[model samples]
Target: MGLRLLIIVALFLVVEIYAYQAVRTLFKPKWLLISYALISLFLLVYIVYSFMQFDRAVGQTQHTMFVMGLMLLVYLPKIVITVILLGEDVFRLGASLVNYLMYNLPKNELMPERRKFVSQLALGLAAVPFLSLLYGIFEGKYNFKVIKQTVFFPDLPDAFDGFKITQISDVHSGSFDNHEKINYAIDLINDQETDMILFTGDIVNTHATEMHPWLNTFNRIKKYKYGKFAVLGNHDYGEYVTWPSQKAKDDNFKGIKNLYGQIGFDLLLNEHRFIEKDGQKLALVGVENWGKNFKQAGDLNKAALGVNQNDFKILMSHDPSHWEYEIKEHPKNFHLTFSGHTHGMQFGIEIPGVFKWSVAEYIYKQWAGLYENKGRYVYVNRGFGYHAYPGRVGIMPEITVIELKKGSNVG
Candidate 1:
């Protein structure tokens, strides 16, 4: 922590000296000196918090603490914006970055080797913010994806083979301030050649009407022989946002569930339905939002309790962890499970048979994609929406088209 503090201090000193010199070159005001000192103080706190929490584990509760400490600096921006709006809005890191790129960058006095190193780091760091926005564009439309695993049920007849089920998770439609980008996303989903469309969870950021505008696009999406289906996600229930009364919140929740029906989706709540073709059956079971410290994962045990042991089953529960810890170990094994709450966080590496490590792994081993044990398969689709972070990085949104096939009893 001490070493990290030193590094932070050193970086701040370098940037401050450069900034002061640039400001003082023309004329230095006493207020400017005071402002710089305050900014330095804020940096001191931010850097110290970041350093102390730098080594915290991502899976444990400490992980959220780490993120909260870093975001402490982020919240100051809105306060700073309202109180002090002029001369680059120091708290708005984006503004400072633009200024640094456009001006102070050319003024570095370091040696050639040192100069190039700093230049590269500066450019790379600056890229993360813009790259986040680009992530939003691609993620909203479910582009740049990796297929985790394609599961096949041998019990399924040839008639249902190659039946592609498109899965979308975390739409967070209320987050769409950019209509064009959202429309593009809707167009992309509507254009897919999918048989069945399943929305695992999280249809809106809050209000049910938030999804009304997207209906035209969602309507265009080709439904399967079984039709479109959805289960509630943590967000869809409006727990994150506040209402004047519990009744209001419950009303909103029911409204969104009704919206799902209007959009041609059967909102599943701890229920099961069989998809039939050619005298064969594949039971698809869905549960309402539920999990540890998350939504009520609903009851997979009850949802599947009625299914015949011999019939193949597909379970759609939002959080992937449910599959890892609960369903996989259950007595009545599920042939395939589909989940999408992770969104791969809209960032990470999904290279097939390659390395996979991200914060999501800390909480959900089945974070994004397919994991199998025995004959049971869990396919965690990279989601189709963005959330609080507001943009994706390496992980793009996904429109999962899972084509279940028939495999031999032996591997």
Candidate 2:
């Protein structure tokens, strides 16, 4: 880890130096150049210091946000500059070859000096992402968007027709910095007034204590007629942090389970529950965290123990990979599944019906939105809160409302 950190720092320094040189060439004033250098140096030093203190300060929301904000303000812009500089170097190399072959020029005079216009252009282009990132930090993170979808099932009970279910995932309450913003988000969820609510894991980041500060605020979520249900996501298992002893870790897990209860959630651990209306029932099955590369404690068969294969079943699993690897292929067909572990990588462009894409797509096939395979469906929520990056980019936080219908319309 130390060696990897050194390599990252060295690479960042190289980019910083290149960016500094570009600024120096653009502005010939010594004072301006010195000022830019000092600012860059300070940010770089702070980044290193933040890395060194990460373990100790990881629980501090302000400290984490500060370090992440610095990276966005300084490092990202420099990376853009580096890309532009590298492109110019490629042009220079080509020009040098042409001069050597045609004019027999010396290596020193083969290529022209770096263009001031190029530096200016690079700076202009770099501002685009820097500004976008700033917007993400200030506005985009709290830009909660409600996505509604209607799923049609031929065998869906008539009583469940038009039954609305609100789903939110990956709260990661440990990373929250503002109470008002969170309260507003919770209010938005309640505004949906869905019949039932389903949370697909990740209430906190690492430890159970992370949810202590926001317990009351989240507990204020309006009650659903069918009640709210939740399942464990990989992060909720207390596996990321080192505990003093095995008992401490077990206690932390217990506390997390208790927190869900305090929030009025029926926390399911490889279990199934029934939501009935007018003598018609649908099975709501929830399992522990299961993923390709993450923890696989979730047992589908165990969770489906009492669930009838013929009944319309909605499975709640944290990772979408579980749906593809296990749920989809399981002998018993599931009408729908809900998941949100990817969080769309908390970044990406998603224009409904036009185009939806994110870096997370490469990692998880069903990263976001709805996907269907042989009548089995899955909807991966984009998440309700931000995490490690401290802010979202193109992808904003999500609140998903799904209404189940009894029949399909092919038109």
Instruction: Write down the lDDT of every candidate, Cα atoms only.
Output: 0.67, 0.89
lDDT of 2 by residue, 6-35 (tens): 998899889988898789878889898888
Backbone collision tally, model 2: 0
The digit string of per-residue lDDT tens for model 1 on 171-221 reads 877655556665666666666676778889888867787789777766666
**Cα lDDT of model 2 overall?**
0.89
List candidate 2 segments past 4 Å from native.
Answer: 56-61, 409-411
TM-score of 2: 0.96
How do all models score by TM-score?
A: 0.69, 0.96
- Evaluate model 1: give its lDDT: 0.67
Number of the top lDDT candidate: 2
